[model samples]
Structures are given as C-alpha cells and as structure tokens.
Target: METTNEFERYQKAKKQVEDIKGFYGHLASYVLVMGLLIFINLRYTPQYLWFVWSMLGWGIGLFFHAMKVFNWFPFFNKEWEEKKIKQYMEEEKKTNKFE
Candidate 1:
C-alpha cells in the first residue's frame, strides 16, 4: 500500500512537472514564431501591421494556457473548489438539523 501511494505521488508530480514544461515550451514557440512573423510582415509590408492580429489571437490563447498551468485564478483552482465543496456540505449539514 505504501509503495502504491508513493508511486501514485511520483506519477502526479511527474505529470505536473511535464505540464509546466509543456507550457514553457509553448511560450517559447509562440515568441519565436511571432517574432519571425512580425519580421516577415514588416519586411514585406512596412505600412501594414497585420502581425498584431495573429499575435493578439494567439496571445489570448497563451494567456489562458498560462492561467491553467499556473492556476492564476484563485477562485477556480482545486483548493478553492475543495473549500467550496466543504463549505456547502457544512451548510447542508446545518440545515438538516432534524437528521
């Protein structure tokens, strides 16, 4: 049982680390690709800044990806969910005084 628990913990940690690494990899790729795209756009069309569209669109996605990986939204994270669940359960228990 102990070994199983240890193995599960190890797997969870590994998965979390991999997720963080993946997010960083995505961020690096975004920077490199967007940089190249901006360079190309400027070189070909100096007056039109169309690269901003792709950058903005992908930037929003990247922002959400970052939020998910980092758990930036406090109210929506696992801990918050657990707390809310417990709070609601306690409230329900209180309301069921007859039981």
Candidate 2:
C-alpha cells in the first residue's frame, strides 16, 4: 500500500535524522576536547582566561548539540530540511511527468 512518494519521504526523513545524529556526535567530541582543555588549564596555568574560553566554547558546542538532539536550532531545524526535500520532490515530480 505504500506509494513511491511515501517511500521517498520516509527515506528523506530517515536521512535527515541521521544527519542530525552526526551533528550531535561531532558536537559531543568537541565538548570532550574542551573538557581536556579545561583539565589542562586547571593543572597548568590556573588562569581565569582559560576558564572563560572553556565556558564560551562549551556554550557554543552545547547549543549545537541541543539543536541536533531537539531538532530545532533556529535556522537549521527540521523545517529547513523539509523545505529542501520538498523542493527536490517537486523537481522529481516534474521530471516524472515528462517521462
């Protein structure tokens, strides 16, 4: 009972989800790097500037992570992908009609 259009939509959605997951995984690794920096700063210099940099980097990385996890990050949300998919589908529809 599943039409080709339905299957395509499903695949598109699945790929989008995977892309978001990739983003989260990347951000998590970035956070880990920042954690290492924090550790080094604490043991070596104990400077407030290092702490500040850690906080800033963590904030930016966490924001992206949350966006990926929650599927809503201002300009880079599900809606944006949806729009792109829709555009592709529209073009496909036109090509299919011609065929």
Tell me each candidate's TM-score. 0.78, 0.55
How accurate locally, in lDDT, is each candidate? 0.94, 0.78
- Please name the candidate that would achieve the greatest TM-score relative to the true structure: 1
22-78: candidate 2 lDDT, tens digit per residue: 877777787688778878888898855476666786788778676666666666666
Q: Clash pairs of candidate 2?
A: none
Off by over 4 Å in 2: 61-65, 73-99
Off by over 4 Å in 1: 1-5
Worst 10 residues of 2 by lDDT: 46-55
- Evaluated against the true structure, the overall lDDT of model 1 is 0.94
